[model samples]
Target: MPENILVIGGGPAGLHAANELAELGVSVSLVERDAFIGGNPKKFKYKFLFPDLQPAENVIGELIKKAESNKNIRIYYSSEVTDFKENGKKFDVTIKSPKGTETKTFNSVIVATGFEHFDPATDSKYSYQLFDDVIDIKDLEKMMGEGNFNRPSNGKPPRNVAIILCVGSRDRHVGNQYCSRVCCTVSVKQAIELKEHFPEMEVYIFYMDIRTYGFYEDLYWKAMEEHDVQIVKGRVAEITSGPDNTVICKGEDTLLRGPFEIPFDMVVLASGMEGGPQSPEMSKKLGIELDEHGFLKPANITLSPFKSNKDGIFLAGACTGPKAIVDAIVEGGAAAMNAYIYAKKNAQ
Candidate 1:
């Protein structure tokens, strides 16, 4: 019999890993907790991706297609690994589905469970759920994807919008202290898209640090130079109700050392990323390690970033840490190669 592999995730990473191994003649059981194939990006309906503003469908949709068409890959949607145990060098995983529970043996397993978006409502400092006009970046992405980029209060085009960065990330008070890695670029990309759609509407990004690192710096520069999106050096301390149907952002301008209360038609929080409950859930179920940041801890973060603490189990994508879609896809391929190698070596 051909060696079998189990992949737990349907996001870009899981989907790509399944496809890569299937191409090498490995039987893959691709399981996803969600009913659909695409993970958060598709579930949330992200319209465009950063750096290039390409349609998110162009990437995730394509992965879904390749995975579904592969003969060696069997998809299990709306399912999860309910039980996992080691069987020598292989694994016995019990997948619970709508039909019934079926246990399968696999030579290797890949956990690509992705991340969760930080909910700004948790902090309460931004009045995220309190104000009608206050929405997070993911909410805005869904709005844009659905072709509705208007004020939530009245469904009117916003005359001026405030994009607050580092909302739920890098804040010790909220308990997450790591930079989400892509929020900065995603915020700038959205700013550019907003400017493109409404040239007259003003866009302002309030950030302690504009961290569009590496090649993503170009998107930041384009937002300022070409799109005229302004970047203010400050952090919004509190959000309160304002007159004339607006929200007031009260904060200090760190650069000028001046306190200011600015009113805007709408507010968008560039919320960070979180490991969510899935990371710990998987860690407990599969007997793996979790980093202090709450993401799945790899065997060796530098050399074996894809390998989990268990010998026959590997990890990829946001499961280990926050990553861009492109980075996740690359890691997916790398994890697939490693998983395949392990499966081939221990094949009966």
Candidate 2:
């Protein structure tokens, strides 16, 4: 029988790992909690300009189709790995599906479970729970899909919108010392989309720093020059609701070194991303080590990108760390290559 390789989470990392393993004649099984395979990338509707702006749906759709046709690969959608028993050389994995629970044995396991959105309620001063007009960036994206960008409290398009970035990310007080890697670019992209929708609407982005590394610098420039999105270097202190249903953002402009109050019809918290809430539980079950921020600890960055400290177990995608779509895909491919080599060397 071909060696069994189990890949958890049907995101880019898991799928890529499965694909590479199958190419080397290893039997691969992929499990995902969601019915779809794209993970967070599937949630996006717009195109990214840096690495060829293509609808996320199109890119993920093609990958899904390719995986489905692979003979040595099997996919279980809407399924999750509930338990794992490491037996020194192999793993006994118990998976739960909607129909029933099933257990299987595998020679190697790959944990590719992705990250989750940061909760805005972390900052009580933001008044996210108290105010109905305050929405997080992901919520705003979902609302955009509904064909309306109007404030929930009022049925009118926001004249002035304020977006706060680095919330729960890069904040030592929040205990999330690591940068989310994608929030800055995601916020800029969303800001551009909003400008496209409402050309004259005033949009302000409150950010500690604008990280537009690599080719993404072009997109950041486009957002500022073409879209006319106002970029403010400040850390937001609080958000409150006004009597007129407007949202008041209070923050000090770090560059100007002065306190400023900005009133907006709507407020968007460009919340950070972190490891999935269930990651701790999953790591404990699988005997994998988690980093300080609760993300899976990579074996090494310089030599190995997708390897974990435990032998025969690898990690990929946001589970290892926060990354954009392209970066995640590349990491997925790298994980696959590592898994393939491991299986080949240990072949019976």
Candidate 3:
């Protein structure tokens, strides 16, 4: 029999890995916890992506298409690996889905469990759910996807807006101590979009640091020089309702060393990412290492980030950490190649 592989989490990483393996003439079993295949990007209805304002459908939609059309691939939607056991060099996995329980044996497994957005609700200081006008970057992305750019409260165009960076990330108070990796670039991209949609409105980004690393730095420059988006160095301490139906941001300007409470028509929090409950759950079920930040810990972070602690398992995508969609897709390809090599070696 030909070598077979199993891919978990049908996000961009998982989808791409499955497609790559199937193309190599390997029988692939792909499992996703969600009912659909496009993962969080599809579920969140993101209209556009960063670095180049490309339509999200162009990226995730194509991944879904290729995965579904692959003849050597079998997809189990709204399903999970109910049981996993190492049977010699192979692994026995039980998948429970709407279609019912089915078990299979595979030579290798790839975990791409992805990540969950840090909910702004947990931190009451943002006043997220308390005020409809106080939203997060993801919320704004969904709003733009629906062609709704107006204020969420009054349904009117905002005269001025504030995009707050590092909402739930890089803050000891929120218990997330690391940079979320993508929030900075995503915030700048959204800032540019908001300004382009409403040219007359003023847009400001409040950040302790603007970390648009690598090529993404070009987007930060474009937002400032081309779109005239302003960046302020500071962290917002509190958010409260203001007079004239506006939101107030009380923050310290680290550069100038001053405290100021600015009012705006709308506030967008660039919240960070979290590994969510699934990461730990997978760690327990699949017998892999999970990091303190809740992401799946790789066997060797520097050398073998794609390899899991276990012999027959591999890691990919945001499941390992916060990453851009492009990064996740690229990691997916890398993980697939590694998995293929291992499976092929053991096929004898």
Candidate whose lDDT is highest: 1
lDDT tens digits, residue span 1-348, model 1: 888999999999999999999999999999999989988999999999877889999999999999999999999989989999999999999999887899999999999999999988899799989998999999999999999889999999999999999998999999999999899999999999899989999999999898999999999999999999998999999999888999999899998999989999999999998998999999999999999999999999999999999998999899999899999999999999999999999997
- Model 3 is weakest, by summed lDDT over 10 consecutive residues, at 167-176
lDDT for position 154 in model 3: 88
Q: Candidate 1, residue 29: CA error in Å?
A: 0.4
Model 1, global lDDT: 0.94
CA lDDT of each candidate?
Answer: 0.94, 0.79, 0.92
Using lDDT as the measure, name the better of candidate 1 and candidate 2: 1
**What lDDT does model 3 reach?**
0.92
| Prediction 3 TM-score vs. true | 0.98
**Which of the two candidates, 1 or 2, achieves a greater TM-score against the reference?**
1
Model 2, residue 107: C-alpha shift (Å): 2.2
Candidate 1 stretches greater than 4 Å from native = none
Cα lDDT tens digits, model 2, 225-295, are 99889989998898866657787899899889999887789888888888868579667877878888988
Q: Order candidates by TM-score, high to low.
A: 1, 3, 2
Per-residue CA lDDT of model 3 for 180-267, tens digit only, reads: 9899998889888888899888999998888999999999999999999989998898999898999999989998999989999999
Instruction: Rank candidates, lDDT, best first.
Output: 1, 3, 2
Q: Could you give me the TM-score of model 2 versus the true structure?
A: 0.92
